[model samples]
Target: MKHYTSLLFISSLLFCWMFISCKSTQRLTDWSLVWEENFNQKKGFNEQVWSKIPRGGADWDNYMTDFDSCYAMRKGKLVLRGIVNHTQLNDTAPYLTGGVYSKGKKVFSDGRIEIRVKLDPAKGAWPAIWMLAENADWPVGGEIDIMERLNHDSIVYQTVHSYYTYTLGLREYPKSGSKGMIDPDCYNVFAVEMYPDSLSFYINNIHTFTYPRIQTIEKGQYPFNQPFYLLIDMQLGGSWVGTVDPKELPVEMKVDWVRFYQQKSIK
Candidate 1:
């Protein structure tokens, strides 16, 4: 019975991979790849394109650690590790995790962004591929979440936050029908196409959510005009994601690639 169950699980994963891989190419054929991080090297990433957080930066109840060991590269992909009480580092957090950002080098304007990732659904895992404004203050600068999942659940959350969404109490949750369900155990594509007028989110190239420009609200939600940088993180546990189970130690978020593209202009 166990062997048969294993085969079934493998078949499901293969099906998911086939569906996701084909959809990514179909959706992005119109745009040309401008910048991409394939995570090719085994040791250290391209310092010019990506940067890591050496120490966990946390002022709230969430755990953040600066230990570099929480990250690694395997099979030509970047792996973000989350572990319990990473005692090897001087970080004071109860848990140690990994985070990386494309802040200075890879900030981009309105375009297409795609990330291929595989997540472990162990309890207490909060993995996300998101973006933040290059300038402005918190809650006012704007945040675009391409994908975020909590506690190994199947739902993928895509949200936009700004002064308007904050005052409206819609930061933590979406404005309804703005989420999709996905299989985290297999590689899936999460994408966002940011236009001057609106933003669209997708899972495996399937349109799942959309956020339009709220013009009537003034600067309440208009902070998304400038460039934004990408951030990929594997958070251990927090207020919204709850607590991490110590037994589910050494969980990881595997990222195959992050590619950015721009639509070619016609002559």
Candidate 2:
């Protein structure tokens, strides 16, 4: 009888340890890489992995601008340089800028996504790395903003928009006063872990926020179950970041790498 009791206790302890380890591994930073853009070397963008959206004043997320010079390279890095010009109304001329998306090429369903990037501190420069649902219209398919920074404010925002609700909302991480100018020179990592019932965000391996299942739509309406593509861009100005400073000529957002990971399912 004692032998059997000892065996049962041992089993319980093993089970508990396994459970705790699993919970820890589920953390946003703990996921292992399934896909990655290291941008280790090379020059120019990888056409197979990215698609440029071209220059247009479409007011995406209240941003105003016709076009900007945006570039991507096979080395895995993406660069967006802002130019200032006095030629045309939307012609923030001399500036090289624009945005890129993994629209037709890549999309993810449920996994961990991470991007390592640097932002340009110039006023009116807005940079973001985010995701969009694969469906035909937006907000209807859902939008997940993993990282977005307003240059003037020196603050970053993470947000989600879903058709299940009609409200616009966001969670923010503002830079401390002592941090000084938030610019492209200082690199940062932004990441998200997506699960069936929840999603979480992390900055440089530090867990910052979590959105629970209660805030999501029902299973049938969950647009996140389908594949979603990634986007990286820099906007000149608009409602959020305000207008670009006429004096601040060329500004750029530099990206080091973009990576994706998935946890192994328990069989």
The model with the greatest TM-score is 1
Itemize residue pairs with steric clashes in candidate 1.
54-66, 55-65, 55-66, 56-64, 56-65, 56-66
Q: Which digits, one per residue and each the tens of the lDDT, describe model 1 over residues 77-185?
A: 8998888774665555667778788887779778889999999877888888888887877678888889888886888888888887876664433352277989756
lDDT of each: 0.79, 0.66
- For every model shown, what is its TM-score relative to the native structure? 0.85, 0.72
* Collision count for each candidate, in order: 6, 13
Cα lDDT, model 1, residue 223: 73
lDDT of 2: 0.66
Q: Candidate 2 lDDT, tens digit per residue, 1-267? A: 999999999999899868755754566344567888765556656668877765554544333233433454424566666666544565444444567788989888688888888777777787778888766477777777888787655557776666553333322211111112233457777888888876777766556677655543333234566688998887777776677785875777778888888886655
